[model samples]
Target: MAVKSLTPYPFAPKDTVDKFPAPLLYIGWEDHKLFCSPVCVPMPPTTTFGDLVRGTLPGIYSAHPDFARIDWAQTEWFLSGQPFTPDMDKTLAEHGIGHKSAIRFRTPGLTGLNGSCF
Candidate 1:
């Protein structure tokens, strides 16, 4: 479905990078319905991808039973729907991840809670 506005909807987007103190990054765990949707978080562009995976992600996904079981070596990653291999030590800006970029990852042997896709 497409929306047909009767009048011009001219307004600045509230979520634009300039409005935030830091860039916003979206992340999701594939096959995990418990989250239902990706989570958006503000992070400095200087933050390393490793910190994102090892530090930030844990804080958000630790509630899931499979989170602790994931093997980082076997995980697959995607950025904006394209396969991505991140350099652990590189900053987000160095990897071209700007504000509003989305990153998704899948654990090879893990598929939701009890394999229920939840």
Candidate 2:
């Protein structure tokens, strides 16, 4: 077998290709209304469930105190009716979760740190 020498592309990939959207996923979970507006989260395709949760939880809950109580570590992520494991190794791209992919987050119950737990 013979090997061919490889060289880098003359132009930066960014120069000729269109960039993916700034926000990579539409992440959301239901409230009393049964459906809530999904927050647009900026994430890379390589991000894992744990990474996404930890990375965005603070910002999301910071703005919406209503989400303050749910234990992020215990949270469950679902896409297209399938559960996402929290091993923190799965990448969104592996499951074809691409731009604007929808991810629903679920916790045991709705309770903020300040709120009483049932």
Candidate 3:
């Protein structure tokens, strides 16, 4: 076996990335929402996994007085005049698609098939 000499891609952003924890805290109020993505955010090698764990907590955890009583990750609250609920599980169940993985069968190879499965 032989090793080849190679260099890191030059065009890639050198700005260090930050890794975030899973089961992350997300916020949704009216038409606005914010959350971190495990699929999108990148972290530097220097950042310990523990730091990732702490970073996912609510941004207001450091300041607000009443936020401690609520699990911001699972609970929703409005900062403005919009109506909101703290129970994300129940709210999503009522508003979101329950069965995300429902199969839609299709056959592309069959002749005269319009992408439908019989």
Q: All models: lDDT? A: 0.92, 0.62, 0.28
* Model 1 alpha-carbon miss at residue 38, Å: 0.4
Pull out the clashing pairs in model 2.
69-111, 69-112
Question: The CA-based lDDT of model 2 is what?
Answer: 0.62
Q: How many Å off is the CA of 32 in candidate 1?
A: 0.9
In candidate 3, which residue pairs clash? Answer: 75-86, 76-86
RMSD versus native structure for model 3: 18.8
Best of the two (2, 3) by lDDT: 2
How do the residues 81-103 of candidate 2 rate in per-residue lDDT, one tens digit apiece? 68866556676677667766788
TM-score per prediction, in order, is 0.89, 0.59, 0.19
Name the Cα RMSD for model 1: 2.7
- Largest lDDT belongs to which candidate? 1
Each candidate: how many clashes? 0, 2, 2
Where does candidate 2 stray beyond 4 Å?
A: 1-23, 32-36, 111-118
Summarize candidate 1's per-residue lDDT along 8-116 as a digit string, tens digits.
9776666779999899999999999999999999989999999998889999999999999999988999998899899999999999999989999999878998898
Question: Native-vs-model 1 lDDT?
Answer: 0.92
The parts of candidate 1 lying over 4 Å away from their true place are: 1-10
What lDDT does candidate 3 reach at residue 87? 31
Q: Which candidate is the best by TM-score?
A: 1
